[model samples]
Target: MSKSIKLLAMFGFVAAVAACTSGQTEEEYVVVNPEPISVEPTYTGKYK
Candidate 1:
């Protein structure tokens, strides 16, 4: 019974350490906006 108690304690310690170290990753993000384009008239001469 004593050996089984020691084994359970060791397993619990390992699980706690694994959980603490597995969630430490952080990500960064960036956003960008482009300018709009302008269009001019095609014909400017008078028609008969």
Candidate 2:
């Protein structure tokens, strides 16, 4: 093959690989539970 044709093919292959890898990135989300739990009192206070 000619030098120019070989160079063009190499450039095309590099561009294709770059495009494919560019779409493989992923983003993640982190969740945090911020609500407080409610509970009944263990004992009742007697009136003085």
Candidate 3:
């Protein structure tokens, strides 16, 4: 029917607009190594 054709055309137009606008990249990420932590030994006094 004519109504179905109009609805299909509208859907196609919307799909085309969405497809055109969805291909943008805005951000990028990079991975890096983390720093190591150092530990100090605990000293015990000469008491029981």
TM-score of each: 0.53, 0.54, 0.51
Candidate 2 Cα errors over 4 Å, as ranges: 30-48
**Across residues 1-48, which tens digit of lDDT does each residue of candidate 3 receive?**
999999999999999999888887557889998886877767787773
Colliding residue pairs in candidate 1: none
- Of candidate 1, the 10-residue stretch with the lowest lDDT total is 39-48
Candidate 3 collision pairs? none
24: Cα error in model 3, Å: 2.3
Query: What overall lDDT goes with each candidate model?
Result: 0.87, 0.89, 0.87
| Cα error, candidate 3, residue 5 (Å) | 0.3
What's model 3's overall lDDT? 0.87
By lDDT rank, best first, the candidates go: 2, 3, 1
Pairs in steric clash, model 2: none
Q: Per-residue alpha-carbon lDDT of model 2 for 1-48, expressed as tens digits? A: 699999999999999999999989977889998876887667667863
Best by TM-score: 2
- Pitting candidate 1 against candidate 3, the one with the higher TM-score is 1
Predicted candidate 1 versus true structure: per-residue lDDT over 1-48, tens digit per residue: 999999999999999999988787657788878666877667867882
